[model samples]
Target: MSITFEKLSYTYQTGTPFEHHALQDISLTIADHSYTAIIGHTGSGKSTLLQHLNGLLKPTSGKLVVNGQMIDTKTKNKQLGDLRHEVGFVFQFPEAQLFEETVLKDISFGPKNLGKSETEALEIARQKAKLVNLPDDVLEKSPFELSGGQMRRVAIAGILAMQPNILVLDEPTAGLDPKGRIEMMEMFKQLYEKEKLTIILVTHNMNDVANYADNVIVLEQGRLLRQGVPTEIFSNPEWLNKHHLGLPQTTAFALKLQERGINLQELPLTEKKLAQKLAALLQREVK
Candidate 1:
């Protein structure tokens, strides 16, 4: 399903004395089955925008159509139930939300809440748990008894059990080590490719953005700064630096090589590509 934001704006604590504008006249379309990344510094409304994907937060001024559901200030809470099921959100440290006595119960919670029979929900949870690589023995164990990373997998499995078409992730890998981070990202990539899930990820990691996202959205102080593919968005190191944003690791390294007079036709985003280009240059020089 596609999402279209039309002149969307949102305000926090809308009335009274402490109102703050979090989004302003944002217009964009997220294509079906695409991986899109939202990037910006803190307080840039990235989290605020994620809430609107499933009507958790209604637009204050304009309207957004998410999977055919129109959301505005006037849209009733009752109207959002189905949309909520279609757009599953995994907040930062999602493991903190786990509360059931057993991993099976926690993972089956969403499906059960959606009115699935206990047997059906448990079956769905079992499938999702395996999909996340959780061992069968983990199902009967308390989620709290598992390691932090395993707990996170159970939380994500809960969302997957709902079978959301659009999976929204907010800093999903915030506190993991380098190895853990890569594993988490690769799992999401598999879901995107194999399950055809449309993913919207909010993260500060430029490497993740370059490696995974097909498209990028830049938000600045609650306004749209730019929206484009990874190449277009990361093309201008100077522009990104001006906004106090960093480039992918390979892109940064390539810029340093350029300063030393290396002729790269274009900057490479991934480590493998950058290594191949440098290797080819060395082979030509030796010949």
Candidate 2:
């Protein structure tokens, strides 16, 4: 299902003295089955915007259409249940939210709550555990006994068991080591590719945004700043710097080369593309 924001805005503590506008007049569309990244510094409304994907936050003024439903201030909480079912949200450090006695029970909770029978929920949990790369041996163990990475996988599997069409990740790789981060990211990539699930990633990692996202959205102080593909967004290093944003490592390296008058035809976003570009430059010099 596609998502569209129509001049959407959100406010915290709407009427009181502390009322703050967390999002303001944002408008954008996230295509179905696409991997999109939302990036910005803290207080830029990235998290506020993400919550709207699953109806956790309703638009304060205008409307947003997601999963064929229009959400606004008037949208009732009861009506959001089905929307939440279609969009699984993985908050930052989701493993901290696990509470069931065993890994299997933890993963099976969502399905069971959705009315699946015990047998059906268990079957779904088993399948999702494997999907998230959790071992069968871990299923019977207490979730608290597993390593942090394993616990994270179990948490993700719980969301997968619900079978959401759109997976919303808010800094999902936070707190993971470098290797663990890569594995977790690759899992999301495969889910986006093989499962054809729409992935909405909210991250501060420019490299991941450049490497994984088909499109990027930039928010600034609760307002829409820019929206484009990674190339277009990263091409303007000066602009990014002006806004206190950093480029992908590859893109930053390419920018440095350009400063030294060794510019490529275009900046590369990933390491492999950087290698290819450099090799092509070498080949020309050899000729």
TM-score of each: 0.97, 0.98
What value of lDDT does candidate 1 attain over all alpha carbons? 0.95
Highest lDDT model number: 1
Lowest lDDT block of 10, candidate 1 = 52-61
Against the true structure, whose TM-score is highest?
Answer: 2
lDDT of 2 at 218: 96
Q: Candidate 1: TM-score?
A: 0.97
lDDT of 1 by residue, 1-287 (tens): 68999999999998969999999999999999999999999999999999998888899999999878899889999988889889989899999999999999999998898899999999999999998999999899999999989999999999999999999999999998899899999999999999899999999999999999999999999999999999999889989999999999999999899999998778999999899999999999999
Candidate 2 stretches with Cα past 4 Å from truth are none
Residue 191 displacement (Å), model 2: 0.7
